[model samples]
Target: MMGNVDIFEMMANRYDTPERIQISKATADAIRKYLVDTHDKNAIDFGCGTGLVGMNLLNDFNSMLFLDPSQKMIEQIKQKIDDFNIRNADTLCFDFEKESRTNLQADYIFMAQVLLHINDVELVLSRLYDILNVGGHLLIVDFNKNDEIVSDKVHNGFDQNNLTELMTKIGYREIQSKTFYFGSKLFMNHDASLFILDSRR
Candidate 1:
């Protein structure tokens, strides 16, 4: 199994900074546009660090499952759930890349600023595909391809077209993508642009 520990564990206590709150709000608003007939659906916020984006999107779904590998991050989400009496939300600490969860299922799955941290993109994408119910949507929000950045622990970014091709190979259909937000000091204080990719399982 992949080690779930990371810097997020240490940062969980102070992860929800004002800057992240603002970005999460914007990302949630953008994600809301593509969400349709979701009032009766269950959604999973994959790699939901402290539930920033998921918390903004609770009312749109029947229930929200905040999943992250970082236990501290999951604890943060649990505290928020308790603090707000958010009965429709829950948290789980598990790594999708570690194993396939045949019993787990959701009508919608979203990853906001989460994919870059994954070591194996295609593998995790396939794992998510298994977790989604047929006709359900997998929404990914992350930085677009950026060759300027270099990292061994994370991706520089992703090429949307290439991502679409990958999803198609994994049995996802009705794929679509759009550039949603841009910032000068995003992604480690470096200028970066973000995009959202929607694919159906």
Candidate 2:
């Protein structure tokens, strides 16, 4: 297991890199199209590294809790959002790996590039399900098994069939997934997929 401090620092640096920035932008745009079309103002961003996804959510939300396990990552996010003068967000350095919904809840819970590292996807899904209000949604953007290159590493990428089965077993219904591009043509044409699930089932 990575120490909290090291994980934060690593993610802080990772978020600052150009590759991550590009990927974050694509992920954010896809999320907006998928979940923010209805535009609920209350949301939570789990593993919100550098607030990349949170920043994009700002246009569609009034209140958002940005949660992560790394103080360094949160600090970087604070600086990034502060540089742009965004203040309607809250930060919590809680490790979902070790913590549950004991302290927070939201209408929409979003996580980008975070689920691949989760060893207990079902347990985490259950926890998120507990915190989400009725009619709430959970949106996860991560690498999919179709990405032939990075699929081997970096992400525990899943095929749509497997993901649907996994979420169904966890009591999440209306599970859907779609693929999208990241970076320029140099990257895989379909490098990522966004999985959306409604907690009410």
- Ten contiguous residues minimizing lDDT sum, candidate 2: 182-191
For model 1, the run of ten residues with the poorest summed lDDT: 1-10
List the RMSD of every prediction in angstroms.
Answer: 1.5, 3.6
Tell me the whole-model lDDT of each prediction, alpha carbons only: 0.91, 0.70
Q: Model 1 segments beyond 4 Å from truth?
A: 1-4
Please, what are the lDDT tens digits per residue for candidate 2 over residues 1-201?
322346557657665677666767777887777664445457888888778877777878768888888888888877766787776788888876676756576878888867766766777878888888777788887665554555332454657678778778877777777767533343345434444433343
Candidate 2: clashing pairs of residues: none
Estimate the overall C-alpha local distance difference test score of candidate 2: 0.70
TM-scores, one per candidate? 0.97, 0.81
